[model samples]
Target: MDQAITMNKTSFGTATTGKLGMWLFIVMDGLTFGAILIGGLGLRIGAESWPAAGSVLNVPLTAFNTFLLICSSFTMVMALNSIVRGDQKGLVKYLILTIAGGVLFLCVQVWEYSHFIIGSEHLESILKGAGFTGSQFLPTTGIYGSTFYATTMFHGLHVLSGVIYLSIILSMAFKEKFGPDNYDRVEIAGLFWHFIDLVWILVFTVIYLI
Candidate 1:
């Protein structure tokens, strides 16, 4: 029984202290997101008339943004794979691509947020030209806007955090610090990045799609 327990623990990928700690953080962070999502759903269900997200949200733009983020997840995977294969150059290349994807995703999200918050004429015209219809969606607008911003901004912050984390890992990669013999740090970072991507999928579905 003891051996079985040990096997199970090792199977979860906590091969290093860093990996174990990251896994713990991921669990706690996941619960926080779960609570937020559940609370938001409750609020929406209780509200008499929830605003239609599609009307206010620039769906096409956000869909593109989502695609961008998903692509980052792929780049992250390739980065890990490259390091595991003892290809430091490939690792660095993929890391740069992943970081670029994250940066671009954040930029697009900021633009979306600004439009909803300021609703300037120039911005309005730009959005309208892009086929956006709804007006300003400030958090003060109603429950819909409040929940929308709260969830997305929270997730955005996570993406920003992930980007910073990946940047640190990238710096280390540039130093050639990780290799097949000692690449747990890179794997740990990949775990976090992938979690961010997965959570965003859930957020997009709950907040934007339904």
Candidate 2:
């Protein structure tokens, strides 16, 4: 019994130092996101002239982006499962898909920001012709604009970082650095990716739908 307790299962799908550290970091980061989101909610709740949902914001575009992010989470899970089954090619394939999802999400988000901040003539014309009202929102626009960009920009940084992290894991995967006996690093990276996706769900609900 003592010997069993002393055994370190680092290579047999057990939590290692890196995994523990990532979980700790995730907890702290989650708290930080919570504080920012709560602060934004407070401001929004107190604002008497808060803009209605879909007024200035393009809800349809953002909803699509949200769906893309959620799909990325699924791909990340698939990547982990593939590696656990000792399928290197499957791991690489899913990781590439997951990374593509993150990249596309960022691109769409940047386009959305441009529409809100710099004002897109083509998009505005289309919306105006369709009888929809569109307004430009910037950090300097007002409290709503400030909080909106702050929350999203913060979350965007996480997505960008997650993409980079996954890219490194992909590189390692190409070198056959992970197998059924050892894939803790990939699992650690997946935890971070999943956390980012979950946070975006909250951000979408609060900042977009609400």
Candidate 3:
């Protein structure tokens, strides 16, 4: 009698290895961000008084930056859809637009950091005029600064990493590596990009708005 042979599958549920790996990474990364934000909130609650985020940060400008990120997320989805539909040209265009949006967001964030944290001459004068000492708003002076910079800078680094990731994907895309049969790479990249955007929303609401 011949024995029946069985082949072992190497995927989780319906997801392939790469897709399952990306899902695992996103879950772990989400938890990391959640812990940081929750700890920051805990610090804020424990403190007698926390520096008002709106008073020191440019709310309008950051709000606009948030809009740009949201638009980028849409463009990313369009890019993924384009590739899936066999429109390589559309995919490239939308990917470029997404990269542009990410770059613009980083530029605005750099400007905000420079104006408020690094080059604080103007902010100091404004704080003095407002009857509060300059150091009060400085990141080095309190737990508020510590938590704020820690969380924001960490998110910024993730954004920077995402941009670099997208850039590499764009290069491969331009070389025509992605198509209907091989679009899973693009989808994985999109998953990471979307997670970055989602984390920023949480960060904005928790750190800036509240």
**Cα RMSD of predicted structure 1:** 5.8
lDDT (Cα) of model 1: 0.85
Model 3 superposed RMSD (Cα): 6.0
| Per-residue C-alpha lDDT of model 3 across residues 1-210, encoded as one tens digit per residue | 011111112222466688889999999999999999999999989988776667666788989999999999999999999986778999999999999999999999887776665546777765655445663455674677788789988999998999999999999999999876567788889999999999999999998899
Report the alpha-carbon TM-score of model 2 versus the true structure. 0.87
Maximum-TM-score candidate? 3
Q: What is candidate 2's local distance difference test score?
A: 0.87
Top-lDDT structure, candidate number: 2
| lDDT for each residue of candidate 2 in 31-105, tens digit (9 for 90 to 100) | 999999999999978977677777667789989999999999999999999987789999999999999999999
* Clashes by residue pair, model 1: none
lDDT of 1 by residue, 33-116 (tens): 999999999998998876566656778898999999999999999999998778999999999999999999999999998878
Residue 190 CA displacement from its true place in model 3, Å: 0.2
Candidate 2 regions exceeding 4 Å error are 1-14, 120-135
Clashes of each: 0, 0, 0
* C-alpha lDDT (0 to 100) for residue 163 of candidate 2: 98
Supply candidate 1's per-residue lDDT for 90. 95
If scored against the real structure, what TM-score would every candidate get? 0.86, 0.87, 0.88
- Residue 96: error of model 1 in Å? 0.5
